[model samples]
Target: MDRGTTDRTLLSPERRRADRTRLIDGVVDVLVIGGGVTGAGAALDAASRGLSVGLLEARDWAAGTSSRSSKLIHGGLRYLEQLAFPLVHEALQERSRLVTTIAPHLVRPLPFLLPLTSPVWQRAYYGAGVALYDALGAALTADRGVPTHRHLSRRAALAEFPGLRRDAIRGAIRYWDAQVDDARHTLAVVRTAAGLGAAALSSARVTALLRDGGDDAAPVVGVRVADLTDGSSFVVRARSVVAATGVWSDDVGEMLGDAAPSLRVRASKGVHLVVPRDAIDGGEFARGASGGVATAGGPDEQRPGLILRTPTSVLFVIPWGEQWIVGTTDTPWRLDRDHPAASSADIGYLLGQVNRVLTRPLTPDRIIGVYAGLRPLLAGEADQTSRLSREHAVVTPAPGLVLVAGGKYTTYRVMAADAVDAATEGLPGVPESRTAQLPLVGAHRWNAVKDAAPDLAAAAGLPEDTVARLLQRHGDQVGAVLALAASDPELARPLPGAPAHLAAEVVHAVTAEGALHLDDVLTRRTRVSITTPHRGTESARAVAELMRGVLGWDDERTDREVAHYEARVAAERESQRMPDDRTADAARLGAPDVRAAV
Candidate 1:
């Protein structure tokens, strides 16, 4: 029940071409229009029900908000304060499933130290809330993946996280949640779907919806797709079209020429900061229980991440490899949805808030990466973006188009199932959602294969730690990466400038992970873009060359890929330097996207 089907796991260049040709030549039961988590989930959901599904993404998978999240699959403790019990309960249940069953290797238990600034009343109030959260997890989850909430004294909390300023807390509350490599997890989902009878194609942009009728009464029959890879255009017929485009939901109406569904999905920009472990006061806390970098989704230990309350929202100090992931200011965003810019003021505000409790405050130079993502919230009368609803809505303004929008990352599966249910409403012999029992591609055999990391590393002449990290990222597919390294001695070497990453990952990004461009390899496939201070500029050229043979990129094309990625990184750096969003947006627009086919 847990094993992924053997449809087509390797999404190689050959696979992409064949799938594109197949999609152009025939019709699918369902066509998913986004490559983010939700769209990937929708494709999986429909495909699992024995329906033909075609997934299309303008860029690589998880190219948008899915890649740039807080990276926590949590129950949202703040939502409890707002009395959204059902949402919290649902998220907690999903968290339990992900950690225990669905993606154990990709999602894991992460402890959080919530330093309390107030006295007994504040502790009592928050204590009850956390207790309720644990109770919900206990009731919903059979295995109960994470530890129960533990109340910690100020001294005890300080003993665990010495990075915190001593005077900032009266006491502390430690709770357990889950963290995921958001982009990797999303990729795994899409890959699993592809492995389970789904035609997956990235770099394919849907130009317009094809319909039989010419008027508003016309039902969508297919999509006019433009392949960004070859600048080729084609059309694929579909019985149902599910649009899980998140922040780009409004654009569907524009695509439909004013006949599309009316669903207001407002954008809330959330900015994150990636800083080095040494930037914090505690040095030894950076090491995990497993003697490697302390990671949120990796093996858990006394190394707990920090969660502090800010004036507007909560700020998290998450453990990500050698760096700490600090984030998220929720404010309205009306600019470009593709790449939401994180301005200098945004970073300043974030640092200023987190520094209030940090014994060793981080400077601007301390930040290795600053990325921003937009949250698609269901809009209502509330003007503030934070006040908008996180619950999703499914609508069919036309006969064949199903629009699902406004849900949190934690509830993506539920949203996708709901969307698929709507899309396949009148379809014949559709079974119930089987994704609950379906494990992603790498997850099924990970538990059995995980402990063999050291042995496998020995056989491959690589470090045990490298093999270990590979298992966590690729799960059971660690062999695929290790084989690449074993075949090529150069790939076994650590990537230059970003030595934390191995060169083999670059090649694997192309052959298996659907990485079409240099940006896809650096930014999403592996986290070189965010982890390295160079923003992947130093790794871009070597990475491009590694991918050249796999993708048939000649000398000039490979050079262009490297150059394009460098320019994009420069543009992002320029954007982050600007004082405000408007200027930042303008600055970020300096380097247009490399795939300008659309």
Candidate 2:
């Protein structure tokens, strides 16, 4: 695509307003509610099938469960123990597609080591399971896009992961899975959908479902949406509507009243802690030093990510830049959906589980960031959230309305395809999903751009590492970002308090990524909020000032935006100190939302 064509497809400020106007003035074939992976995927799928699509989200894209995933694109290994063969097969196929075709730039291979606590039985048990996992993947797709699992001796494993506790395990099993920057991948899906003629709008919430007739049995036709940005309300008409709202599926069902869907969605909160790479002695193992077993950290030996089983859930210490993302506690959460709080107890639990295997125990002081998100698990007789199925269900609660719930992050494309299929049930001539063969916006020319990273870095007067990072994050779209910096030298400078990102990224976030608020740019677009120790407060003012130029914000609005971001950071920190969910939720609620203030 030409520069102008690509720029026109961006979720820019101008494009957002234009799309919103067009959506209100005319009816579309499909209207997708929710900006998370599933909804974005659905929009792309529908638009690819020659359907007129409009996607709306109450907040920024991937602002919910989508952004808070474990960042893995693996078939649930534990599901194999549960005898969920079909689910595992489906996910492995999707993972292959993402790594090989759909989003090669965003999703890549990541190796994981599962320690064997009991020498013989544990090793044999895990080996058999992993062997089956590999077999399933091979059976599903010809292009598996990842290496097979391998067994390692104690000495071999130790050489690959010197950080592992010597007494904790006898050996280990290394396997290949894929990982992604979940938020960025979701955003790219939305952008790709927009490029394919889908009208995408953020900060617009669907409040009510519009029906063809006033009766309860009447088919649903449209939605009444409130623009959270300006407190204005409008109705968008569509032939069909699909709700991929994740944990908020129940809320949308409630809006449907007595005709509500039969599905029950239970919210399970999961939390992750981000810490520096050195804290975990990451990448301490030298390649080819022992038993010829390569470390599973990342493409380079720079990141040797690890995974272990806990009493309640699996714990993953994944490599992400200079830091490792350690997480996840699955527990029932009945608190606020918008800002799920991570209590002191949750943090303590994760630290305790991870510290069991780590040579050095990580304390609260070492934690750089903590994030909590809710999963919309399908309610079943099984009381444990871990027991809930990862398979998704598509329900046509009413005619012209489809509700999709209960799927893992890796299978979002499948969930979206199922949702759209249900939405267009009776409509003739709607083509089958083409997203599996279609590459995301940045993936088309990524390989060429990656090969030219060194040249691009030299021309832009940046380190090759910086150019590589930009390529991984934006793929071939890095040119647009560099173009901004080329015209203004100041935009090339690294952002204060977040040296990994450049100032031009902040500008592009507003101009091309639909970052309307300070929170959107910091939290989702750049990840400064979860990576920096100050939770992005140190850079909030500077980023707000840069955004003001594109957004046309005056001094008063700019100041308020920065203050709101700071308050949010403070509230999140305070919440993390609380003992339980109730107290943590109360603490987090102390911060006022910028939308409400406006």
Off by over 4 Å in 2: 284-299
lDDT of 1: 0.86
| Candidate 1 minimal-lDDT segment of 10 residues | 285-294
Candidate 2 C-alpha lDDT tens digits along 1-598: 5676587569889999899999999999999999999999999999999999999999889999999988889998888988999999999999989988788778877778888889598888889999999999999677788878889988878877778888988999988888888999999999989998999999998999998887778988899999988989999999999999999999889877889888999999999999987788654533332121112332345345788999877999988777889989999888899999999999999999999987888988999999999989999999999888778999988888999999999999999999999999888988888988888878888666755666999999987667777877898798988898888988998899998888999999988888899999899998899899998999998899899988999999999999899999999999999999999999999996677664
Model 2, residue 562: displacement in angstroms? 0.5
Winning candidate number (TM-score): 2
Candidate 1 ranges beyond 4 A from true positions:
1-7, 282-302
Estimate, for each residue in 170-251, the C-alpha lDDT of model 1 and write its tens digit: 8789888988999999999998888877899999988898888888778999999889987888998999999999998888
Q: Find the candidate with the highest lDDT and give its number.
A: 2
| Per-model TM values vs. the true structure | 0.96, 0.97
